[model samples]
Target: MIRAATDTGTFVPRIPLGEWVDTAVDWVTATFDPLFDGVKAVFETLYDGLDWALATPPFAVVALVLAALALWVKGWKLGLGTLVGFVVIAGVDQWANAMDTLALVLLATLVALVLGIPLGIWAARDDRVSRVLRPILDFMQTMPAFVYLIPTVVIFLTGPVPGLVATVAFAIAPGVRLTELGIRQVDAEVVEASRAFGATDSRVLRQIQLPLALPTIMAGINQVILLSLSMVVVAGLVGAPGLGAEVVASFQRIDVALGAEAGLSVVLLAIYLDRVSSALAERAPVARALAAAR
Candidate 1:
């Protein structure tokens, strides 16, 4: 008797995910054109204002201001380093590009925080919401940064607007995750004590939970900033002008010196941002008090 053969081939779905996505995107673009246009205008206005302020000032003046900020936040050593780094960037004629990058990063980080913190707070307070958001946050975090640019360009048409939108989306996951974690990590006993003391839910959250969670929240903000900065190159590809554009140009032309200089400028900016944010996180009053008590 002949033995029966079993089917060993893997089954493939007939779903057209790509076409569905395209259709959805087309629907959104058609329906929300005005909203997207408004967003573009607002972002452009903010970017232009920041770029003008940084570029209009004499190089020495802007450098001094940044150095002073570094000194105030981090210390004398970092201040000096910041001053020298900016001077070097200016000397290499990359000051404008650096400033543009800074503007974009700042705007993107702001947008991420605005959207992330509230969502995080909600997630922390509700298990249902948290469960719903977990997969979405995971997808945002795991998706390649370049993947964001496609939909962004389709909707916003390749400019700093799309760049800012993509940067915010790419950078927002850490902000949301850390915010939720921070709030949830607040000591239960402390929370109960506040409740026992006649604290309202809002009061308990505002006075006790948020204060304790400040350091973690700050860390989230720092992560957002770093992620936004990391998107500079991808953003540049879509017409966002910055040091990233210079880096891309250098690559296309194979100008090693230009690439090195642009890369160095980005490094300097990263160092400055990282140090400043770290210092800020450390200096959160609750964080400082906790450290002292420990």
Candidate 2:
């Protein structure tokens, strides 16, 4: 005496959510190990290259150049501050590890911009995507940072790569969300004017909206980099190196002075990166124009 379908078929009950998820993960791991291996290999190659490049004397040379660039783009004060931060990190016997952390952070931030900016543009152009993305960004922003480390560990495995993966995941939402908001907030009249002038969708997006929205997108990038830096210690739990790992080790042993040093290093690094990113974002439109002129 059960409810009957139109056809003579029996219905099966759906699996519980917990069991379904576990089973799906198991299936994916079993079936997609090769795909995962390929991805890991690619990341390893990139990070390994970074490791070699940054572990050399040229890293210090590059730091000096970056300090000069900062002076030109921002101001003498920011340049001096950045130089001081680098010097402090280098002097504290943490140069290699600090560089490793910097490499991972810079790489992750670049990846986020590469992927997130397009998604943001898509969301901005379409009302439906914006509606869907807004809630998701809210979740990414509102969720506790520690909780992000768990799933990241399971997927990427425990190490610097996993930490980088988690840091990117944690930081990416803002860039996407802000980019969407910035583009959408562009003057409707200007967009209409572009359309009236026979601009294609791509032309309007590239020449009109994005140029106008560049500052906002730059702000988003700045925020993303800052957020990635904030997650460094949490990332260290999964084997991310540098001051974060030191912080973790010091805290484990209750070594107050060591922890303080690690913490200060992180703060200094954050300030340096933050200022540089902000300046770059602010300067992008002019730079783009100059590039176009060339």
Candidate 3:
């Protein structure tokens, strides 16, 4: 079969992207390796400290306090759920695993918030940046959890911290996108009113825009936690430990009961975090109430 040389011309197969990919890898490694190593070191130190801490009655006390706080903060349902979830996890001998998972999720979510919020502020202020970032955020949100693990494995190796890194990458987009959206959605009238009172741009952002956008930003945080939980499980394939590792091991051994228990533990953890975050987000006031009114 002969085909005319249309717009394709010589029909040169597109140059393999492997070299470009390699170049990117090299650049990233060069730029971020030190930071990455520093992060790994800090995580390792904290993990050891936490593992030691968890070995004591104090850890149990902390858990009890958290359960109580959940009840205090959100209400009886969450508090009771927290207690029940902890009991179930403990009963399955997955309490430590569950805590490990919790730690990773907390750490990842924190990093995501720290990074995402600023990026979001930048996006909100710049139309061009927002336009560019929206699609990237969409891609991060839509990409499968497991797909992120491969590059994570290649670059960071396997374990809780590497898993934490990947979870942050996969889950942070919502925080950035939602924060930007929420900030932009702020009432122009209110903003003008703030300026009428002689507020500077920074003051308006801090006292007006951010306060108003808080609930929405919080909703984004809730989403980040949920997404982190989902990815953290996929991270088990790379030795990320906790319920996820147990789940993976169970599947590998075809131990239905074991896998089910692990899966249940993950679900419990998700529910606990989800409800707590949701409650907080919903409670933010209008001057504080982002999208909560809607």
lDDT, each prediction? 0.91, 0.82, 0.84
TM-score of each: 0.95, 0.87, 0.87
Summed backbone clashes in each candidate are: 0, 0, 3
Residue range 1-294, candidate 1, lDDT tens digits = 233344755555566779999999999999999998998899999989988888888889989998999899879999999999998998898998999999899989998999999999999999999999999999999999989999999998877888899999999999999999999999999999989989999999899999999999999999999999999667888888898899889988999999999999999999889999988999899988988999
Clashing pairs in 2: none
Looking at model 3, residue 173 earns an lDDT score of: 96
Cα lDDT of model 2 by residue, 15-40, tens digit: 47777866787778678878877766
lDDT of 1 at 33: 93
- Scanning candidate 2 in windows of ten residues, the lowest lDDT window is 1-10
- Model 1: lDDT to the true structure: 0.91
lDDT of 3 by residue, 191-274 (tens): 999999999999999998998888889989999999999888888999997878998999899999999899998998898899
Compared with the true structure, model 2 gives a TM-score of 0.87
**Candidate 2: lDDT over CA atoms?**
0.82
Give me the candidate number with maximum lDDT.
1
